[model samples]
Target: MIPVQEREQTDDRRSAWAVFLVFLRLGLTSFGGPVAHLGYFREAFVTRRRWLSERAYSDIVALCQFLPGPASSQVGMVIGLSRAGYRGALAAWLGFTMPSAIVLVVLAMGLSGAGNQVPAGLLHGLKVAAVAVVAQAVWGMARSLCPDAPRLTLMALAATAVMLAPSPWCQVAVMVAAGLAGARWFRPAQAQAHEPLPIPVGHGAAIGFLLAFFVLLVGLPIAHRLFPGQWLAMADAFYRAGALVFGGGHVVLPLLQAAVVPTGWVDNDIFLAGYGAAQAVPGPLFTFAAFLGGAMRAEPSGWVGGMLCLVAIFAPSFLLVFGALPFWERLRRNAGAQAALAGVNAAVVGLLVAALYQPVWTSAIHAPADVALALLALVALAAWRVPPWLVVLACALAGWGLAPS
Candidate 1:
């Protein structure tokens, strides 16, 4: 007969494997930038899988929004952690990140020789599909998150502020201001029953992780300056970008461009080409790091550099999410914290709204035909309730057909 403890261990392994497989699918299919990624996560975890409750999922989103690095990716890591401890967290990150990283790296290598050859029509189609996906996300999240007048007002103001200023700092400032407003005026009627997040790390471990995060943030630059190696320099640059940026992948572009372009690590044309190609693929836009790494005109380029940059850029996310969860869980239970989260959640939705309009809309919707295409995609997603992956495929074909022969 098998031992009970052995059986439990086996089950835990299976759970981690399951988390990996699910996230791998998401990595292959999740499209439409960070806001749309959140919508995809909500559908997969909260609505479809029932792995997390609605409020629990929102709480996670709210927390990730406050941290640096990619919010959607961090949410995936926390979900994995909740399911199967540290192993699950690693599994989630690897599965959800690798597909696009691999694709972008390969594309980067090919483009170096083949020149910028990806069809512009296909890329534009993907952007239009993204419009529908983001609209669906905003529509659904608004219904759930902004049910009250005060919260709705907060959402409008936040969206307006972000749209006007439209910087990473503005997004962070809006969230902070919204949090203060929530604390002062938006207290819940009565304390509702709480759904405790299953954070496996102890308080001591959490503190250690936070310390490590800061240590690397500060020490990496000094180490690079002191040693002057290619790998260390790349790590320091990518790590700082991930650690400091507030808004998600889009906002990180200028920092990345500055780091690589002026130094001639990557030619300016290749850099812009990779950014365009990044939108054509699924998964986090941060995977553009893989392209930059693979295309670097220096030693340690190709697959080795690609993987290294990918890990370095995303490392802070893992540290921050793990470190913050223990403290976040405790603080969220407080009555005051709940009120503040209410405002923050609304602000997050607003940020999504601004993003949907500026880059997602302005970039994609040019002509009446483009607007028609986006509307059809939206109908497929929100009304017919088709899976996003299928909609993306359909739109790509339509975009190709519409392109001049």
Candidate 2:
């Protein structure tokens, strides 16, 4: 008979393979934005694979939702962590993100010179699809995060505040205010007892990872400023965007656009076009960075830039997840933490709501046909249960066909 340690190691290896294959399939098929990704995860991991219990999965979702990174990616990591170990987490993220990143990078490289020659209607259609996706996310998240009157009120206030004075700092401030409000007002009537969720890494490792995350967050930009290199600037820009953006992958749009476009690293048209192209692909929207990097007129363009930016943008998610996992087990059990998370989740929904209106809706719905296309996409997603990839394809084709003569 095999030794216990050897058996465990064998099991872990198998689990890692399972994680890779599962998330790779998801990378190929999952769509409709981050919130929709969460629903897919729940269906796959919780209902189908039984990798985590529904309660544990929901708790993990709550934890990721409140944190300042890509929530779906974080949740995927946590699921991977629970299933196998750190190796599984890496496998999950790589498998789920690489497909879209590769697609976008290739698109950027191939279409760098296409410019106005490319069909504007197809791009517009993807943007309209994005509108439907984000709107669906807002509706679903609102139901879960703001089901109560107090939470609903908090969400409204958060949404109103950000809509009126839209900026990164404004987003941060609203999240902070919401958390405080939750802690003060949304505390549970009775403390609930629960088992701690398992994290493969111990607290000591978590602390080291957390420290490294902060060091990179603070140190990268300073080093770039001092040393002045294209690669360093690129790394700093992507890293800062990854570290700072609060809501999700979509929320990083403006931050990333500001980072690359104004600096003349990537053209505005290429950036926006990549964003539109990103919507048609599966996996995380953060892969949009890969496209921008590849499409950049600056040095390090091509695969080098694409891979570098992709890794830089996603590195923080790994660090943040590893760092927080140990503490998450404790935080979930605390009434104050739960209350604060509730507030933050509501605020996140509001942020999604706000995002759907501005960059997504305003940019997408330029005409009556655009509005109709978006509404139909919404129906396809929310009502017909048509797969997102099919919806994206349909929208793209429809946009191409419907382009004004």
Candidate 3:
């Protein structure tokens, strides 16, 4: 007779492989941003497979939403963790992220050879498309995040601060201020009860992971300065961007733009084009980092750089999810924490609004034709129910055709 331990091991192997295959398919097919991705996840994991109850999945989603990094990816990781263990989490993330990361990296490498030969109008079309995408994102986020007057006020003020200062440090200061203000002013009446998902990792491991997250966040920049390598610098920059993102994937755009564009790792036009390309792909928007890393003018540019960046950008999500899951039950019940998250969410909306204006709009819309195309794209996304990939393809064709001879 087979030993119980051997049977359990075989079962786990099957579970992990199943998780990978399921997520891999989702990664290939899922699109239309984070919210849609969440819906897809719910359909697959809850409604279809019944691996998790709706309540349990909601709890996982709530916890991930509370923490920073890509919410959908975190949700997938947590689902994998809940289903199997750490290996399952790793499998889910790899399966979901690899499809887009590979596509963006390949696109970036190809673009690197073409260089400035890329038509200005075509690039502008991308920028215009980006403007439409981000605007839709900002509108949706504003409605959900800043529904009330107070949160709306916070978002506006935060956007104003970023617009005036317009630096990475300035952005950090704004978020910190938002969190503090949120905690102080936005305390809720009561904490809500949550049915937390079971996590196998012990509390001590969770604490260690949390500590390591911050350690890397603080230490990477210093290490880059001290060590002085392109790879180190790239890792530091992408890691910091990943750590600080509070809202969603769209917010990562400004943070990443600040990190790489200023350092000349990627130029302004290339960065926006990659952003446009990212919207065209399936899977999490975080995969754009792979494109940036691959397209860098510095050493380690290519697939290696892409992999390095993909790992660095996503490392924090793993850390935060693992760390927070242990404490999520208690954390979810804290009214003050929820209030603070609300404020931060509102502030994030403002930050996105600011980004939509300066880099996305200013860089992309240089003509009346550009404005019209962007408006059309926005309508297709927000009103017409057109698929994002189709919309992106349309924008590219429109831009290419409309380019001045």
lDDT of each: 0.81, 0.82, 0.90
Looking at model 2, which ten-residue stretch has the lowest summed lDDT? 189-198
Candidate 1 vs. true structure, TM-score: 0.70
Better of 1 and 2 by lDDT: 2
Q: How close is each model in CA RMSD to the real structure? A: 5.6, 3.9, 3.5
Order of the predicted models by lDDT, top scorer first: 3, 2, 1
Winner by TM-score between candidate 3 and candidate 1: 3
TM-score of 3: 0.95
Candidate 1 per-residue lDDT over residues 220-300, each given as its tens digit: 989988999999989998998788665577656655766887788887656755665676678998898999999898977
Per-residue alpha-carbon lDDT of model 2 for 1-405, expressed as tens digits? Answer: 998755654764447888999999999988878878999999987786666788888878877876777889989998888887888899899889999999999999877767677787776666777778777777877887789999888888887887898776687788899889988888775444444666778889999999999999999989998999999999998988788777787678766866787789886556655676687888998999899889988889889999999999988988988998778757766888878877887887787777777667777788888888989998998899787778777887888888886
State residue 317's C-alpha deviation in candidate 2, in Å: 1.6
What is the clash count for each candidate, in the order shown? 0, 0, 0
Instruction: Give the candidate order by descending TM-score.
Output: 3, 2, 1
lDDT of 2 at 162: 76
Would you estimate the TM-scores of all the predictions? 0.70, 0.85, 0.95
* Residue 398 local lDDT, model 1: 79
